[model samples]
Target: MKTLQIVFIALMTIFTLNAEATEYHVSVNGNDNNKGTAAEPFKTISAAAKIARAGDIITVHDGIYRERVNPIYGGANHLNRIVYQAAPGEKVTIKGSEIITNWKKEKGSVWKVVIPNSFFKAYNPYSDVLMGDWFNKKGMDHHTGEVFINGKSLYEKSNLNDVIESKPYEEALDQEASTHTWYSEVDANNTTIYANFQKFNPNKELVEINARESCFYPDQPGINYITVRGFTMNQAATQWSAPTAEQVGLIGTHWSKGWIIENNIVSNSKSVGITLGKDRSTGHNVWMYNPKKGGATHYNEVVFKALQIGWSKEIIGSHIVRNNVIFDCEQAGIVGSLGGIFSEISNNHIYDIWTKRIFRGAEIAGLKFHAPIDMLIKNNQIHNTGRGIWLDWMTQGTRVTGNLIYDNTTDDIHVEVNHGPYLVDNNIFLSELAIRDWSQGGAYAHNLIAGKIEVRHSTGRNTAYFLPHSTKVAGVSEIYCGDNRFFNNIFIKDENGEESEQEKENQSYGLHGYKIAKYANISSGNSYLNGAKPQEGETNFVEKTNLKPTIKITKKDHHVFLEMDLDPSIFNVSTSIITTELLGATFISEAVFENPDGTPYVLDTDFLGNERDKNKPSPGPFENLKKGLTLYNVGK
Candidate 1:
């Protein structure tokens, strides 16, 4: 009986080993030749990625990995996703920068570094200037390469003389800093970078250069079902990514599907931080303007072939970029074109985008996306940026809710050239210009708009929309900024629970269109108080009432936005304008509009993830401005 029991136990142990998933470990002290175990781990993540299969977990210890990690394969299914995670509570840094210890002092506080051409090997970003489809060269040379000192990126000077002759870096307002300026000159066999680092010893501090093009990206296409989490990824020599060009980001999901990149710190990217975009081919007719290099057919032939090959769900992208802290990018924190279909980007803190004018382009924002069909962007705090969010082109069936946006230099949210059925709800817009509507058919409800609003009639602008949930071209449609609605909102300029002096002086009448034409728009059930005046002549706003609900915002946290407490019962007064009416474009019904995946969605929860009473919900992103109702609030 004992022998029989031992045999059965051995058989059960073998079966359990077969069913269990593998865990691979990586540490700095390990070697690639060693077995990927906890004691004998691999040296690099690239080595682990080469052998990692479905249901494998790569556990990297606390250290800085200088090399880029290119995932060759994703999992066969979501359940078998390959996860790459930093050890719990460990600081794992995956950087695209290489420390240069070969610097020779040129003069007082000026240094020069000569890198052999073999150092870069296949690709040299210093020689590669920024000029591509939809990219304006502006008759000047611009490289994707960057130089960093101690962590912050230094300015790239046009010439060596500019850095050498310049005085102490000027703290000019709204201008790019010239401190620690650098210039690069590339020859056939070497690339030399000269920098002026006044008062700082280059030999003592960590001076790094943007050596790699991307920090974490797969080379080949269709690498899906992967998760990159809990690491600090930074300092890539990423170039300007236009929809027409081969779009590359610091960490981009390139024309793939089902990727989740969460809980990582992405920063100091040269152009863009994260890209869930198409893999460069001829997109729409956006290349016609830059005809000197190539015509429209020449630039877009690859896209035409791609379309013929079928731009469907199996080929396009649907990625989840959530719970990330992405900042310090020149162009955009997150930018996507056409590849953001059926994706969810939630609980990400994206800020400090496009604050530096060192790189100039029309494409600059905190979060800019093109053709985000049925994508959800929620519970994000975007502040201190140029443009908060720019949803351009075919933005059908998309929902932007539970987001707190404020202090943007330009318009907080710009919805351009989209047709209809998109929903924008429960957002806090506090800035100079809130919503810039070039094309309409969006439903705006339960929002707190504390800024100016503008509308542009773009009936002649021809755009495209995709089939719901797929990238197949639905049809070509012109921009018709009509049949829009705004309801159950709170527009105010109260400083301290009452009208500010600016509101009393009629400075709050900051809503207007170009006034060339008016469309069928509805604006009602909105409480505009604290001396804020209703927009005139165009919108069908309900009669304005002067009632100020108490707004409580405390600066408890230092980095991101503060928490607010505004009890919903405070607005439950006798003169309240609350109702159960459907907000926004009423014509956007089942017959005309459905979700991209043909599924239906209801905004049943507030920004704090609390259930909302659909019959009479309060205004703004909170169901109740109770304390502790933050993005991380778990309905306590």
Candidate 2:
């Protein structure tokens, strides 16, 4: 009775503390000196953030906030998290850019603006060149500074003459928009920007220039349990967010934990959009500073060093990044290294990543992570990216499930240099190159794969793999290739699909790409259509070379649909529901494909969250997919 009374008293204390939590208000027509209330609000979000404590809420009204919100303190735990949100049914935009109207006319359609160097304070983005370990500048200079005219970003030219000429570049995605170019000349005293606005006058339009590095990011590490929601955050001068460097985004966590960044539109970053990455203390571009070792060697060294300095589930990760629309970023939409471990990234629409072909890099994707151990990447629609989901190194116990991935210039998924016990299930891959499997020990099940696969071995770089559902490194092993399980998947090839002659010749569809690998794959109960071949010594697969099903992706009114004609007899193959016990253990990591909490996963749900048959399951992502031409709403 005494123990029960003590527990009740503790619960009552928590309830009382939560009940007395403060709610601060911020508005554009307010003063910093005023008391933060609904009647008398704070002028800036930074003002309210300076005073907000645990379990407090900062409600920002509808306006354009042009300052970077650096929260002074973080909540103690998830239950008492400090939330920074836009007012309900309000349109709030937080930008890293400042409006500029002092543009003098130059020759032709070009204009020039000279700003004092004191305006940039400590960091001048125009002078800061994009350089990192894996970042390739394509033999051209690319600055983090950007020029926006009426909410549209202009392409950066290498020289001022290019802005004066105003000719469209041949390789640009938007050829006409390429003519709208900007060039910067940075001196010790001032920074001059020359831009070709075409017909639009920069002084008359809503012209803005990149002034800040990040819009909403904590300056320090250990700022945990913060939530940012319902804001349109954009136009940051984020740098090249390679894994070896400090990855600052438009709104980043900066090696923090329990940050919930959701229900916001993140766009127009010079590099990455959202970052859940490591700090510089662990190791920052050590390989770039001294090129004595390869990138893999430097990364492997950093992993052990991070472990020594407390890299675990309790300290880092467990972030929730969901329901966000991220786009127009030159690099990754969501990127992290070791700091993304045990995180959940779902229901996000990430696209247009690396769309600007001005630069190339080893790390360019919709979502890229180096050591995403025990992470959950589910139900996200990633399209029109360089690569869809790129998971490199130490991908143990990770699950990439129910994602609708398509139209990627590179492969839909690239798993590189990790002996994973990871799970890829119930996904729709409609790109030309579906899975680029450089690493091994993954379980691919119940997926609708409509493209070619590139399976190769990684013998040179020996990457680390962790214990099941944990960050502890069990062993380090080179990928000999193919300790993988491919079960109940549908591989389709468009024989009459729109392709150039060279593209058709280069296409090697389905599991045939795994033939040249050193190791062998465990393949069974898969359906191959239109010249997609099965693995060698596989007797349980189905082939339909004569049957041609019309398959294509359609987008209308911001909704994505998979228009496909599947025969009803496609479900004739006998397949069992996959489970952790049946998958057993991976060869290198000895980790079973399980949940983050080390529980066995039952693959009983389809891509649309429909219940699968327990006895004999269907061989694709959809359980009750109709016959003939059916338009399935895949974006939901």
Number of the top-ranking candidate, with TM-score as the measure: 2
- Candidate 2 local lDDT, 86-112, one digit each (tens): 999999999999898889999889999
> Where's the lowest-lDDT run of ten residues in candidate 1?
572-581
lDDT of each: 0.73, 0.89
Off by over 4 Å in 2: 1-13, 496-507
Each prediction's number of clashing residue pairs: 5, 0
lDDT of 1: 0.73
List TM-score per model, in order. Answer: 0.85, 0.97
Query: Residue 524 of model 1: what lDDT?
Result: 56
* Residue 81 CA displacement from its true place in model 2, Å: 0.4
- Against the true structure, candidate 2 reaches a TM-score of 0.97
